[model samples]
Target: MLGSAILERRLELEVSQEKLAEMASVHRNYVGKVERGEQNLTIETLVRFAVTFKCKPSELLAEAGL
Candidate 1:
Protein backbone atom coordinates (compact mmCIF):
# COMPACT_ATOMS: atom_id res chain seq x y z
CA MET A 1 0.00 0.00 0.00
CA LEU A 2 1.05 3.58 -0.59
CA GLY A 3 0.77 4.38 3.07
CA SER A 4 3.06 1.55 4.11
CA ALA A 5 5.55 2.37 1.40
CA ILE A 6 5.63 6.03 2.36
CA LEU A 7 5.97 5.25 6.04
CA GLU A 8 8.74 2.73 5.36
CA ARG A 9 10.68 5.10 3.17
CA ARG A 10 10.28 7.92 5.69
CA LEU A 11 11.59 5.66 8.45
CA GLU A 12 14.40 4.42 6.27
CA LEU A 13 15.44 8.02 5.84
CA GLU A 14 15.33 8.51 9.63
CA VAL A 15 13.02 11.49 9.37
CA SER A 16 10.08 12.47 11.55
CA GLN A 17 6.59 12.79 10.13
CA GLU A 18 6.77 16.54 10.69
CA LYS A 19 10.07 16.71 8.85
CA LEU A 20 8.70 14.67 6.00
CA ALA A 21 5.73 16.94 5.83
CA GLU A 22 8.00 19.98 5.61
CA MET A 23 10.16 18.32 3.02
CA ALA A 24 7.16 17.40 0.94
CA SER A 25 5.48 20.79 1.48
CA VAL A 26 2.43 19.09 2.91
CA HIS A 27 0.65 19.60 6.17
CA ARG A 28 1.77 17.45 9.10
CA ASN A 29 -1.72 16.06 9.57
CA TYR A 30 -1.82 15.27 5.87
CA VAL A 31 1.38 13.30 6.19
CA GLY A 32 -0.04 11.44 9.15
CA LYS A 33 -3.24 10.60 7.30
CA VAL A 34 -1.22 9.54 4.31
CA GLU A 35 0.91 7.20 6.36
CA ARG A 36 -2.19 5.82 8.01
CA GLY A 37 -3.93 5.10 4.68
CA GLU A 38 -6.54 7.65 5.49
CA GLN A 39 -6.08 9.84 2.45
CA ASN A 40 -5.89 9.65 -1.30
CA LEU A 41 -2.97 11.47 -2.86
CA THR A 42 -2.75 13.53 -5.97
CA ILE A 43 0.05 12.93 -8.47
CA GLU A 44 1.60 16.27 -7.52
CA THR A 45 1.67 15.27 -3.88
CA LEU A 46 3.13 11.89 -4.76
CA VAL A 47 5.84 13.58 -6.74
CA ARG A 48 6.56 15.87 -3.81
CA PHE A 49 6.98 12.88 -1.50
CA ALA A 50 9.16 11.05 -4.01
CA VAL A 51 11.36 14.10 -4.42
CA THR A 52 11.69 14.48 -0.68
CA PHE A 53 12.65 10.83 -0.29
CA LYS A 54 15.11 11.05 -3.19
CA CYS A 55 13.28 8.33 -5.10
CA LYS A 56 11.42 8.19 -8.35
CA PRO A 57 7.66 8.46 -8.32
CA SER A 58 7.43 5.20 -10.27
CA GLU A 59 9.48 3.51 -7.59
CA LEU A 60 7.09 4.72 -4.94
CA LEU A 61 4.12 3.52 -6.95
CA ALA A 62 5.84 0.18 -7.47
CA GLU A 63 6.40 -0.03 -3.74
CA ALA A 64 2.68 0.49 -3.32
CA GLY A 65 2.07 -2.28 -5.86
CA LEU A 66 0.13 0.13 -8.01
Candidate 2:
Protein backbone atom coordinates (compact mmCIF):
# COMPACT_ATOMS: atom_id res chain seq x y z
CA MET A 1 0.00 0.00 0.00
CA LEU A 2 0.97 3.70 -0.24
CA GLY A 3 1.54 3.91 3.47
CA SER A 4 3.99 1.02 3.40
CA ALA A 5 5.91 2.52 0.50
CA ILE A 6 6.16 5.87 2.27
CA LEU A 7 7.49 4.21 5.39
CA GLU A 8 9.95 2.07 3.47
CA ARG A 9 11.24 4.92 1.38
CA ARG A 10 11.52 7.28 4.30
CA LEU A 11 13.42 4.75 6.36
CA GLU A 12 15.59 3.80 3.40
CA LEU A 13 16.56 7.46 3.06
CA GLU A 14 16.85 7.90 6.84
CA VAL A 15 14.36 10.76 6.65
CA SER A 16 12.25 11.75 9.59
CA GLN A 17 8.62 12.76 9.18
CA GLU A 18 9.52 16.29 10.19
CA LYS A 19 12.24 16.46 7.58
CA LEU A 20 10.00 15.10 4.88
CA ALA A 21 7.22 17.46 5.79
CA GLU A 22 9.58 20.40 5.79
CA MET A 23 10.84 19.44 2.38
CA ALA A 24 7.34 18.92 1.10
CA SER A 25 6.04 22.14 2.68
CA VAL A 26 3.49 20.25 4.69
CA HIS A 27 2.92 19.66 8.38
CA ARG A 28 4.78 16.87 10.16
CA ASN A 29 1.44 15.58 11.40
CA TYR A 30 0.23 15.42 7.81
CA VAL A 31 3.21 13.30 6.85
CA GLY A 32 2.52 11.03 9.80
CA LYS A 33 -1.11 10.71 8.77
CA VAL A 34 -0.10 9.79 5.25
CA GLU A 35 2.35 7.20 6.53
CA ARG A 36 -0.36 5.82 8.80
CA GLY A 37 -2.86 5.69 5.93
CA GLU A 38 -5.18 8.04 7.73
CA GLN A 39 -4.99 10.73 5.10
CA ASN A 40 -6.23 10.68 1.55
CA LEU A 41 -3.81 13.11 0.00
CA THR A 42 -4.47 15.41 -2.90
CA ILE A 43 -2.52 15.00 -6.13
CA GLU A 44 -0.58 18.16 -5.29
CA THR A 45 0.41 16.73 -1.94
CA LEU A 46 1.41 13.45 -3.53
CA VAL A 47 3.56 15.27 -6.06
CA ARG A 48 5.20 17.20 -3.25
CA PHE A 49 6.00 13.95 -1.51
CA ALA A 50 7.47 12.52 -4.70
CA VAL A 51 9.63 15.60 -5.20
CA THR A 52 10.76 15.55 -1.60
CA PHE A 53 11.69 11.91 -1.95
CA LYS A 54 13.48 12.67 -5.23
CA CYS A 55 11.53 10.04 -7.12
CA LYS A 56 9.00 10.03 -9.91
CA PRO A 57 5.33 9.68 -9.05
CA SER A 58 5.08 6.50 -11.09
CA GLU A 59 8.09 5.13 -9.22
CA LEU A 60 6.37 5.80 -5.94
CA LEU A 61 3.17 4.23 -7.22
CA ALA A 62 5.09 1.18 -8.37
CA GLU A 63 6.88 0.93 -5.04
CA ALA A 64 3.51 1.00 -3.36
CA GLY A 65 2.42 -1.81 -5.73
CA LEU A 66 -0.37 0.28 -7.17
Candidate 3:
Protein backbone atom coordinates (compact mmCIF):
# COMPACT_ATOMS: atom_id res chain seq x y z
CA MET A 1 0.00 0.00 0.00
CA LEU A 2 2.55 2.56 1.03
CA GLY A 3 5.20 1.44 -1.43
CA SER A 4 3.21 1.49 -4.63
CA ALA A 5 2.57 5.23 -4.90
CA ILE A 6 6.02 6.00 -3.64
CA LEU A 7 7.27 4.08 -6.63
CA GLU A 8 4.79 5.93 -8.84
CA ARG A 9 5.86 9.31 -7.50
CA ARG A 10 9.48 8.46 -8.12
CA LEU A 11 8.66 7.51 -11.69
CA GLU A 12 6.56 10.64 -12.10
CA LEU A 13 9.61 12.61 -11.09
CA GLU A 14 11.67 10.61 -13.55
CA VAL A 15 13.95 9.30 -10.85
CA SER A 16 15.31 5.80 -10.79
CA GLN A 17 15.23 3.69 -7.62
CA GLU A 18 19.02 3.94 -7.34
CA LYS A 19 18.91 7.68 -7.80
CA LEU A 20 16.07 8.07 -5.30
CA ALA A 21 17.99 5.96 -2.83
CA GLU A 22 21.01 8.18 -3.29
CA MET A 23 18.89 11.23 -2.71
CA ALA A 24 17.37 9.69 0.39
CA SER A 25 20.79 8.57 1.68
CA VAL A 26 19.58 4.99 1.84
CA HIS A 27 20.78 1.87 0.10
CA ARG A 28 19.51 1.06 -3.38
CA ASN A 29 18.27 -2.29 -2.14
CA TYR A 30 16.41 -0.48 0.59
CA VAL A 31 14.66 1.65 -1.97
CA GLY A 32 13.85 -1.44 -4.01
CA LYS A 33 12.45 -3.19 -0.98
CA VAL A 34 10.35 -0.20 -0.07
CA GLU A 35 9.03 0.09 -3.59
CA ARG A 36 8.19 -3.56 -3.68
CA GLY A 37 6.37 -3.35 -0.34
CA GLU A 38 8.85 -5.78 1.16
CA GLN A 39 10.00 -3.35 3.82
CA ASN A 40 8.04 -1.20 6.21
CA LEU A 41 9.85 2.08 6.45
CA THR A 42 10.24 4.14 9.56
CA ILE A 43 9.27 7.77 10.07
CA GLU A 44 12.88 8.78 9.56
CA THR A 45 12.97 7.08 6.22
CA LEU A 46 9.68 8.71 5.28
CA VAL A 47 11.11 12.06 6.23
CA ARG A 48 14.13 11.38 4.07
CA PHE A 49 11.88 10.53 1.16
CA ALA A 50 9.77 13.64 1.66
CA VAL A 51 12.86 15.77 1.75
CA THR A 52 14.34 14.08 -1.29
CA PHE A 53 11.14 14.62 -3.21
CA LYS A 54 10.87 18.22 -2.02
CA CYS A 55 7.41 17.56 -0.64
CA LYS A 56 5.78 17.46 2.75
CA PRO A 57 5.74 14.19 4.67
CA SER A 58 1.96 14.30 4.78
CA GLU A 59 1.85 14.63 1.03
CA LEU A 60 4.03 11.61 0.53
CA LEU A 61 2.05 9.65 3.05
CA ALA A 62 -1.18 10.64 1.38
CA GLU A 63 0.18 9.74 -2.01
CA ALA A 64 1.23 6.38 -0.68
CA GLY A 65 -2.08 5.89 1.13
CA LEU A 66 -0.33 5.38 4.41
Best by lDDT: 1
- Per-residue CA lDDT of model 2 for 2-61, tens digit only, reads 988988888988989998889899987988899899998887888888987899888888
C-alpha RMSD between model 2 and the true structure: 0.9
Candidate 1 RMSD computed on C-alpha atoms after optimal superposition onto the true structure = 0.6
Provide the lowest-lDDT 10-residue window in model 2.
Answer: 40-49
After superposition on all C-alphas, the RMSD of every candidate to the true structure, in Å, is 0.6, 0.9, 1.0
- lDDT string, candidate 3, 1-66, tens digits: 779878887998898899999989999789889988999889999999988878988998888766
Q: Looking at model 1, which ten-residue stretch has the lowest summed lDDT?
A: 22-31
> What's the CA error at residue 9 for candidate 1, in Å?
0.4
lDDT score for residue 50 of model 3:
87
| TM-score list, all predictions | 0.96, 0.90, 0.90
Evaluate all candidate structures by whole-model CA lDDT and list the values in order: 0.94, 0.86, 0.87
Q: Give the TM-score of candidate 1.
A: 0.96
- Candidate 3: regions farther than 4 A off: none
Task: Tell me how far the alpha carbon of residue 53 in candidate 3 is from the true structure, in angstroms, after superposition.
Answer: 0.8
60 Cα displacement, candidate 2 (Å): 0.7
